[model samples]
Target: MASSRIRTFPQRISGAMAASLGLLALLVTVRCNEQVPVIMWTSEGISLPRQAPPTAGHIVGHQQLASYLEKALDVGPRNVVLFLQDKMSIEDFTLYGGAFGNKQDGVFPNLEGALRSSSSPLVLPAVSWPASNAVIGQLQDQLDTSPLYMDPDTLSQLRLNASSPALLVFRLPYGTGSDLLSAKETLSGNDEVIGQVISIMRSQAVPYTAVYTGLQPSRKEAAALSVEGGLGGGRSLLQSRGGYKDRWRNRERQQWAKEKREVYAPVEFKEDDRTCMLLWAKGLTVGILRNNRWEEHDLTPATFGEGVSPRLHGSDCDKSKARLVLNYENVLGHRSFKLVFVMSQRHYKVSARRWFTLDAVELEYDGTKATFNGSRSIYAPAEYSYRCHSVTSFRWPLLVPRSAKDPANQWRVSFDDFQIQGFNLSGNEFSYASDCAGFFSPGIWMGLLTSLLMVLVLTYGLHMIMQLLTMDRFDDPKGPGISVPQTE
Candidate 1:
């Protein structure tokens, strides 16, 4: 009985171990198959009709107007009349012109020629020009005021109740009282569209010219004038009359100069005339204690250099056993802090390549110093990739006391995105200028390979173990010895 018990003991232990592994795999499968709720419940939601936002119209400047006139007159002799109308939008013009002609093959025909040929009742008058003496005199008179502005007498001659192949210049008044819309309505009533008047000069046969100026905020500004006093009032407040656009530009300049005087810049420290150690962060941010809460403040490259000082101590060329101290002061509105990085060099087990590792982090802040002792330590290799921004960011959540002896009343300080470089470095400039290394790191691939190898080894060992399950020698005192049958 003792011999039988000893032989079966190993089998019982093997069965129990296999059962536990099977249960573990089953639980993992169940956990993976679990579905997370996307939406727990639904409620009645209000549906509102959507309305498009009002868009402003673009107006051509004086230079563009001159370019258009020069191009139009260069083609042939044509009467050119430029209309400078305010409060009329380009959208209104495009829409009203489309109603005149039926679109041919899903595209509108040249509406300009169509409108001009049918212009029997539309009133656009002709102006007669004289020799160079009168032309040069008129040009010289309006040059001081506005070259585009014509006197009311010249403009008054443009009123003919019927349409003629003549130029008509209309200086539509701004504000709520505008005559341009009424003129547009009159042209539409006469079965003539006013929008396509510009394209009439595009053809050689056409002899008339109409220039349209689509201005904004007059039609739209009527609504905003009551609510905002004026459309430009808010913008004028940001930019003062003195032409200074930046309201805090001078204050920022002064603060930068003050910060320049407060902190020392980083300098390259040469060790044993062999290697150089210089540290700097591309980005830095700190949580400042304000109003019993933490407010975030980002430090620019200039401000970061003015506030933080990097120093290397110890005489190790690899900088593995050296101490890297990053002292920050006059930052976060004069809050001083120090970070000590204890580094070490580690090599991959399968390769000759080596990289640096952060062994520990010692923080000094709020008049108290503490070494961070946590379950998660920075044991991974310091990422180093050529031409990449392979930064190793460190975040430390620290407790700062309010007073010297006040333990309960403490403020939490968070240091985030403290990306430090130049660990175990030797050169004039920094390295790793772009993104980090690839997604599946070497360590992750190694782990997956190792797990697969372990599974294969376990499978083979179980197969060999199963082959060893031969029945114990059983001899019967009969004619022949009975053997246990092997069943798969």
Candidate 2:
């Protein structure tokens, strides 16, 4: 019996050890599931939004949205939407009015038509989103004591997940309406913020197509670690410069053209006036006026949104790929003017900052005055203007794509600031501008720094240890040898 027991013990121990090893190997493999990189676009240079934006009904506000996104959209700690929490006050309408206060209270704006098919708003049907208690609990602190205008981030985040994030949208530089450019121009420093958002998205290889609106605060201090380098001037209708909108479509591969409501672009010149600014075609640039001042006025009637330009035929013009010549002869002594053409949409999509190179830029105005010569993509090189001084950027224009086969009106195109550079002259993608991603992204730079730091530290530590040991060993005659028998 004793001999049998010893034999069984060895067999049992061997089986258990094999199982343990198998489990350990599995856990390691599972943990090694590498995360696919993601792109992030924070409105106004702020990646984490602190305040709740008035979006898709604050039925649930920011607090709820953040929690919902953290669980559903983010893959791990490294991939979640990070909200910058803040406190603010809204009107406590419940105190001022009772149950019958607002006529719209009982009638949900979006669900009014389906009321008969469902229960009353007072006791809504069981929802896929969190219970009202869960959402309100998360927001209780950030929001004021107002009952009607309660914060609802948690609820929103839940709802966002239930629906298709691919279709979720953003407003232009201003409020969500037609006047995208004027709304954007009202607030300055837009260029700087845009540059930052672009770089981060590009480097992480974020898959969603994006949109942005509102003024960029130019007063923001330079940040050693800021994605876009720093803020602009800190000007705007909002109270502070940062923590505005920390939003992103939380889906894998958010295709643009399929989801974009508005258009955005980064430019170097505000108004490039060189030619008569007539018939224009596609290629991604607007025409320059003769006066050297951009004349990208509202081609769209006041009734239309600023982002929407009048049809090409509406302006009584045909599709033509015109050029702007920066000749000193055209540089009128008295008339300091330029023209910006709002080309049709056969080619230019008025999309977000991706990547492109300024192959050749020459100043041609019927004379040998200047030449736009360069091999690099940065349009604003130090010697940029010196070589083409006379071409002082009527503040560049953009070419709205033109479809040769479409009716003239169908091909009509117009853009505002934030639009295809109705004013901004630079032809760089916002994603890579100023440490932001224009033609480039911020993730690329950050990844590079991270790798370099790791290499340097590891290499230096080994060198120091070798030096310490060698210093003492120099006194030994046989060079610190330890003997051991050879094994066949």
Candidate 3:
């Protein structure tokens, strides 16, 4: 009995080991399966919208539709419709109010009629994208079959083989609507046509799923549409710049003296504008620190809610220093975020021509500041311009928490379309500083010194070789100038 027990113990141990290995393999398999689909269904140029289409009842994800199709295949021969309409917005549909709370009438009458009749029609909002080759390839990969491309206008001619599951993809023609109401009518007609086709499919007892893709309209078009027949929401739509709001908005409401400024102050240039410094800055952008990096946030009218507006200060000329301040109310949890730039201006001579130099620059944001005091001495080269200078890339680092230890984790701010005038600038011509390469860097100087040393060594060696004349010390006096053989 003892011998039998010992034999079974090893057998039981082997079985346990095998079960653990199987479990490990299953975990690895699940991980691999989870990772593979993300890469497989990964697409580019597809932006999940921030706001839901007001008219599209609900939006469905690509994965959700794909999963539904996969399951529907098991039920019976499935007919899936992927209707990709071009440049259609959810606001165009009479289903919901437009982006600015405009009353949208029945733009999709036929489609609405069909939806009313159907018990459970799968109509959900999707992002607007034209059917690209990549999208087609993705669909093919998911369905394990090439989609039969058919025109939505000629859907009556679509002949799908009922024996096999069909993935029907219809790409409507691009709309040429001149105005908003026309655009609405055009989109409505498309929806009606598609809806009529869907109703026919239902009558044929074919199990079908329909998807409608819509675009977000441009500000220009929205404005034009608002003028034609839209409610006053068009102005609001044009002013909409999407961003997250922080708690600083309440603080900004109480503090009005520090934040209010003119949106646009006329730029004045004098005939002899040498004493003052004027800086013009457009397109203000703010960067917020997140995950130890600077994430860009475009400062817009809508970013700080309805009442507060972002304004640019410092259009007026200053005698001593040029100051340009971009103030944002309620930005990144701050009640007032000001990007202040102070540049000290001076007149100088360059190549017998009168030029101006910005000797020093001080940039301040939040609580930290980056000051660059340029060399103004005659010995050191400085950036001196004859006219106005424009800089597109002026980036400054902000002192963040981890930045003290790791420079790579620092946050930075950037400026664009920045111009400094009042330095004898005439007309539209700009003159940049010639001394961009101020001095040789340490590495360059080292390389130059190494090259000079090599040249000196080679020259010395050549001189020594020239001086090494072989003397005819071997005098053949006995042999009457008989020279020894050159080579023995």
Candidate 4:
């Protein structure tokens, strides 16, 4: 008795549209106070180098980043707490003598007592220092908790101390180098872990010292001279550098720099400058041309092998920096891409002629690449990676200056990032500033807006599509000989 018009209704949303809106709302809500362009995939990672990296190189990155933050708060080692998430600071030749002790936690006989000493680096009085036994024990537990993304145990340990100027280096699990069966499995939960960290940070009221990501190539992490390590560390070293002449050196360092010299002028080709990030599409095999146009660069016999293609280079100062990263998102056909960076030093050793150099490069995008670059404290490029240095990638941090000579007063380090945003697999490297005003540059915000619009349009289009499919309108009127297969 009822003739239905198929319950005609204008579909306003689809599952995809609803999901997109939810994510957008979540983004807007999560970033209410911040105007900085939101990067969603930033995940948690650590860099526990097998041995100690040099102090001079590792301390400068943070120092520079800290200088930028000091505008709001009086900052330094004394007031701030340092979290050596990985072996980066511990293993490199450069040393950072903070509350966390040395590579193995034995550097300081007593962290609390050390801070209390007159010669201690503490700017704040020992009474204000959070370097107590309980705090140290808590930190040890946190550092050793899961050895990967911050698990509940690690989170509990982190929350145990209310240290004011705390510095954290969340190590990527693969630094251990034992059970990384594949790439994705090794760099686990980077984006998820980052989200968790942001949640914890937001819940707190008192703003703590700056948060950072430690970046490096675990493969280049040299072996610890001590007997403390197990099978994993020794194996990783052999797998990467076993056949090389200098087992202790970065085989690819010099070559990385050589490429940079080709692109820019010698002056522009200073150390620690990023050239570009090489990206490839995901869900792709070695030979297939991605998206019918983008070329493939999966040199590895097996797709997505652990080794990185582009080499790295920098200065002897170990103060110069650069980074090359990978990326994948279905929106971009899940193509792989790179983000190269050139970071300037914090406590730059000023000379009549200022020069900078780099140590190693890290590959991000796949979760496993987090051990080195995810920390945000490291950078490198595929320049000149040839010859005698014992190691390639290591933990490098920058220290900031207290006072300035010019309002442009701040250091002028160039930044080159290679990005791929649209349907095109193409990208290019570029230079930018990290100063206060440039921190939130117009270009980044514009990109974010464009991405947001695209997401919305795609969502709405799908909503209409789903609506049409579910209704009687999309039904095959003939309903016969409809055995045609789909085509790409």
Candidate 5:
């Protein structure tokens, strides 16, 4: 019995050891297969979009609609019928009509019938145009007899001074089955009538809105339509220099002012102007414009830390122009990024300091780009009313991994085409760091701890095995021992 128990002890110990090793292997496998979540940061805060679709039956007021029309169709007429037709199916068209309050007034049986009996104020005149000048003269005589047909100039002035007109709503028949090409052909055939109607509207200075219910258009088709309708030429009414001024004032009122401000002087770079070098490195192309000329340079690992100083003349000198410096500091497990922008100018007899703010910053990594709108300002203190310089520093968290083994984590910094709002930089340089930390990340520390625990467990198991193998069996002679009983 003692011999059997002694042999079974080693087997039980081996089984337990194998079970522990298996559990550790499973844990390691699970950890290795886990996916890491990515986190992004901006000045506003962490951004996460609400996951709900917009509610149905939302009513957009008249003022909101006017704003939309001004932005989408330009500041011309408040009322205009924009027919967006393409190869999309009718089913796709039904999905887009909620914005204008899709209330049905009447439904025409077919497209031809719809055009003939269309309630649209713009189309009605075109439908009723006289075919001959004699007919037009007859209508004019009838109009002259009525007191309503007073002076034409007065009528035009009244139309111009009138408030915005009501929205004209129309819906296509549910089963038109008409393709985009066919619909376009039908409208093109009526071009003469359409042109006459447009001429009359422009002459009268009246704004009218019309909505054409048809198939939805793709992005390319929409862009083409916008160009054809002259909707792409005008500047947006909502955006202006005054908007920025208001933003600055609001920031001041909210007590969000920064410690310093960078006051940048005006600098213009024309396409044909050649003054600075154009640097191309790692799929990034930067055009350095200086002194009315452009110079070209290539950025690489070898030239990363080196600074390029361009020669300036007259007003283009460093004292009058903004200077931007880009630096990369390699630290343990990651890389730190910093952007330093300096603005300097000569001030005379001014005791007060000037303040300027950076409105936005845009960064592009490889092919992906992100824009951040955070205000960082600097104050330009006068040096005895002679010279003043203000510096603004922007620091970004570590981005690149420190481990060379992680080639996937390596990223090349590019700022040649980087956009810094509210200032046009005159010069820039890339600086690199010489020293970096090794195995400094939290993940590395956790891995080391796990490995140390595993080693201790393995050592304990081996020590137990050694102790069992060298144990004195004869010490327990009364219970279980190796004895030659027959010989005795």
Candidate 6:
């Protein structure tokens, strides 16, 4: 019986080793088959039915406008197209008088024919005179009616003809409220015209600077219309009043002088000028902490525009210096969504301190209470000495929705005063470290432990083989001893 047991030990050891190897393989297969959740980030606040945020550009006098165009053309090959409303140009109507059937009507009836026949140079007194390099091509004037009347095919052809990074200048007619009917009529027409043009530009992803020089109810009205038509915030330059013009020009000169004095000023505040994007769910309730009091601010589609903050000002803090906080909650029966906050400061600088926090905990910044789970600081060096804008972006993931069909849940939060300390690093160096224990799931740890056990098992198997190889067979007195016939 002892001899038989000794012979079977090898077989038993082999079976146990095979079983361990098979179990490890099964664990690996099970772990790999499990699904991993995916997360997405966006800069545009919660998804909405409104148009995209506007681009950045300035609205100055004709001379300053011409300078911008000239600079744009001098750099490289660019498509610069001009659209002039026949109402804004007396010369255009005079040149194409016959097309309207009666010269006194002041209407150029045949827009296509007039555009094809006109040979005069496209000129705007507010921009520049004479010619600056023949950069402006494909001038479409004698457009006496709303752009809605123009041929869609012609617009399509124009878009195709325009090169990448094109500059489209729309000098449309904006009516005043003195004549309500006329104003309504003009606005409706203008909306349709500008809307179509914007659609084309957006489809082609072209960068355009629209200059509205005609009559309008007010500067605010003009800006609202431009933003509604999808012009970028800084890119659409509405023509302001003469007083406003002088003030803007003075500011520009002062800024230029400051730039000349401190060549490194931009480097110091480089990160402040950048565009920051934050996203949150729609219909989120927000609050502002002011003077140790919390003020509620309702978030709605009507409140958001080209700027980062809503239309309503919550606190006495300066718009540039104000800090923002986002809160998210995890609960049952709610739709999961995100909010996107985009800040684009042109010729100005802005700094952002971002953080994340759980719904169960409360956060404090400078003695003000806010809710957040994590935080991060962002900084970027200036890329251009004269004028450069930094673009920094971060995202926060809300809790997974319990049900996809639940009505959107609402939450309120507030922003309070906070101090920021600056840290400068040479060249563009960045580091990220996380201490959250739950960041990794259980499967990961299990896989690691299984690998360690496999390594130990392999080492033990090797040691057993070595022992078998070097052991003395005579030392086992219980085994089937060599039949020496027991000479004693």
Q: lDDT of candidate 3 vs native? A: 0.41
**Number of backbone collisions per candidate:** 5, 82, 0, 90, 22, 34
Q: Write the per-residue lDDT of candidate 6 for residues 1-488, one digit (tens) a residue.
A: 01121111111234477675444333222211111110011111112122121121112233544454444344422443344332322122222232223433323222222222322112221111112112132111111111212233345666433344444444445344445456435544654565566456556654433322222112333324434453343222332333676576568657756765642111011234432222222233444445676455443333333334432122111222323333232212223222322121122233233222221213222333323321222212211111112111111222221233322112233221111112222223111111222324576789889999999999999999888765344646777656555774
lDDT of 4 by residue, 221-303 (tens): 23232212433354465446546533323433355446645442111222234322222222222112345553333322222
Q: What lDDT score is found at residue 403 in candidate 1?
A: 41
lDDT (Cα, tens digit) per residue for candidate 5, span 29-137: 2211111110011111112231221122122222333333333223233343332222222112222311122423111112222233332211100110011112212
The TM-score values for the models, in the order shown, are: 0.26, 0.24, 0.30, 0.19, 0.18, 0.20
Alpha carbon deviation, residue 284, candidate 6 (Å): 72
Candidate 3 vs 4: which has more TM-score: 3
Q: Cα deviation in Å at residue 297, candidate 3?
A: 42
Local distance difference test, each candidate: 0.37, 0.26, 0.41, 0.28, 0.29, 0.31
Top of the candidates by TM-score? 3
Off by over 4 Å in 4: 1-151, 157-164, 167-169, 175-181, 204-206, 218-488
Candidate 5 scores a C-alpha RMSD against the true structure in Å of 34.5
Which model, 2 or 4, shows the larger lDDT? 4
User: Between candidates 2 and 5, which one is better according to TM-score?
Assistant: 2
Indicate whether candidate 5 or candidate 6 has the larger lDDT.
Answer: 6
Predicted model with the maximum lDDT = 3
**Angstrom error at residue 256, model 3:** 36
User: Worst ten-residue run, lDDT, model 4?
Assistant: 34-43
The full ranking of all candidates by TM-score, starting with the best, is 3, 1, 2, 6, 4, 5
Q: What does candidate 2 score on TM? A: 0.24
Off by over 4 Å in 5: 1-98, 102-254, 257-440, 450-453, 456-460, 463-467, 470-488
Residue 460 error for model 1, in Å? 34
Native-vs-model 6 lDDT?
A: 0.31
